[model samples]
Target: MPSSRISEEITFRKLEALLAFMETGNLAKAAEALEVSTVSVHRALHSLEEGMRCALFRHEGRNLLPTEAAHVLADVARDVLKSMAEGIRETREAAGYSADQLKIGSLYSLTIRTVPQVVIGIKTRRPDLQAELVLGSNADLLYKLKQGAIDAALTGMPEPDPEIESIPLFEDDIFFAAPADSRFARMEAIDLRLCRDEPFVSLGEGFVTSSGFMEAFRIADFTPNIVMKVGDIFSLMNLVGGGIGYTLLPGRVRDMAAGNIALIPLTAEFDMKQTIGLSFLRRRERDPNLLALAAVCRMTRIAR
Candidate 1:
């Protein structure tokens, strides 16, 4: 094949089909994996062989046997595809195309305050930019950030991962929530030791608040008599109001507290606080949207 034919006919789609077929060892399975018809996969593979001017496969009755050359090409194709994907991502970052839209992830608890302020600050800086917010638990947000599903996240300070860069925005004190008429609600500040025997309503394990709650108990050297483990903060608060059990949350949630629910500060000894921050992959430092969002998070003050 001429060099020009190789350049013109060897498209990325054909290379992708070749790789899929090589991996699956069956044209129909490759077609299903690629969400294409079997005929299309066969056409792509044929086109690739024609462009290379080499017999990549041979027919063995009903089976297609890959030649040694096919294996070599498949390996090279994998690297080429990965390089192409990285090139496109870097190009978009450099060209500022991604700056027009930012994808942000955060804990649902922050959506009521911190996340909104950060979004506003970013929009103030770039009026044409769009922001999409995804709210989930701490573990979920961090996983999505690592997977590149979201450009950045506002969450509890995650453990130091070399792949991730975190900017600490502010520290929030965790307060105890109880029914208004409860004896604990009458106190100005309550120590964790004082409530050791009280039934507790907890946020489930994956939540950032859950870690802090556990830490408080650990510091006090006692396990909470937890009666319920919930997915969201509001549900926990509601349960507290209904006199089911008490829970712990940040001071920022005071505004959303129901009249029947009372949020009491903790004593200095039980001063459990979570460091809320902005996090992103260290490799994405140069991405304009991520940089813009990070800038806003650094300067904006979230109400305590």
Candidate 2:
């Protein structure tokens, strides 16, 4: 086979044949696995080997023995096939071709209010659409959106990534959450500097809330004595409610505040606020489900 043909003609079907033959170790079994004739499998392998200018198999009696080259090609073929499959799925989603299924990513904090309202609104508009919600931290959701794993995400305004288009939904005020009975909780507004010596329970670093919490400390010109770092907001809030340590959270979390936990608004020169938004790949703007979800986000009044 010519090099030009090898470069341009090595299709996914040939790679699939190569992988199936290597795994099954027999032309007949490979054919059965691929739902093709044994002759077709043999021809595919032979053409692939010829195209690559290498021997991929040795035949003994009726069985075909795979060479080391075959094994290497099999590995590469697996990755190629997997990536191709993912590409197809992503392309279909971007073209608004899903079978009435919409994948949405969101922050765990929004599950209580923002997420449910958006889901309800989408269902109301498109009765046939099924909204699948995936909850994670801001970073995780943004990563998924960029990877084309989710149709859209409801998260904090991530540092600008040119691939992502963020539609600002609402702004949430940051507050200091402490044990209800504590002296700091009794105050109308907590001064940022007053908590300099207090133990703090914070969300792990990748979270948008964590960044805001750290920024508040930075503005106060003091390093908080962080005692524990947790993955989720609810767990961090529970730790504060149990008197483990105080934590900084947005106004949205106030609804879930336990009776033992007090949420005091922050009064400081640095306005500690989180801008929540709907984010998706800029290329996916034409997707119907994404457009519908965006409409819902725009119309729905997110409670704080």
Candidate 3:
């Protein structure tokens, strides 16, 4: 029978060691799992039994057999340890550290250099911050921002929205990009109307680039011979590099312009640029994680 007299010598760690030993049914195996010496595991179990003033185990030759009292204690120990872990997690989340992961959203095109800069800057400021990037179009990123799925978004800045707040990072011009070997590539500048007969690959709807892509052609007063539509900017770049079709791309992606692709300037009449910014929900503007993100954004100065 177990006594009601409890000892201050009992500790959560000793109970953990006891649970490990009871579960494994071997002292060496328990120590190996806990990454401790076998002697340490044996000592902890001995202390736990002494603290509770109960016979938790008995020796059988060289092996040890757990008593019914040990089984009951181990069961309670399992629940207690699990609850403690959950409580710690809840505490951290309430303090505004999201399991240490900072989820951020951005457009596919900005991944070239801008997103990396922000991620590195934020992590540098918060060494414990694990920056996670989620890529999508302007619409997709904004949707995630409002849904509370991401801490902030690096995307093409939209007109002032009542539900959101933004800080402009930089501006990038939309340029006509074609295969280097194509006839239009040799031109220093291109007229949108001249490319009406040429095949084009566009970004799907909701993309900021797609809006500029369509608006440019609309201003020229003729629909382009659009050959295909793709989801990501990298894929669009690949297709253009492969000579699939010419498309409008932001100057931020100029690093990707090497051998196969040529980025030609758009004529003044059709020239357009996108303002890139860091956006977050208006309600959560004061959130510590969002504030950290805004601080990083304020420090950024990306030249056009």
Candidate 2 residue lDDT tens string, 1-304: 5544545446799999988877886778989999999899888888888777788888788667888898888898999899999999887866545547888998889998888888899999999998888888888888787776788888998778889888898999998899989888889888888777889999997789999998888989999999999999999988998899998888898879958889888886856888998888887787777788888999875533
Misplaced by over 4 Å in model 1 are 1-99, 302-304
Query: lDDT (CA) for every model shown?
Result: 0.87, 0.85, 0.87
Model 1, position 185, has a per-residue lDDT of 90
- How well is each residue in 73-111 modelled by candidate 3, as lDDT tens digits? 999999999999899888867544445777899898777
The per-candidate count of clashes, in order, stands at 0, 0, 0
CA shift of 2, model 3, Å: 40
- Report the lDDT tens digits of candidate 1 across residue range 101-204: 78889887888888878888999988888898888888998999888788888889999999999999988889989899999898999888988778999988
- Which pairs of residues collide in model 3? none
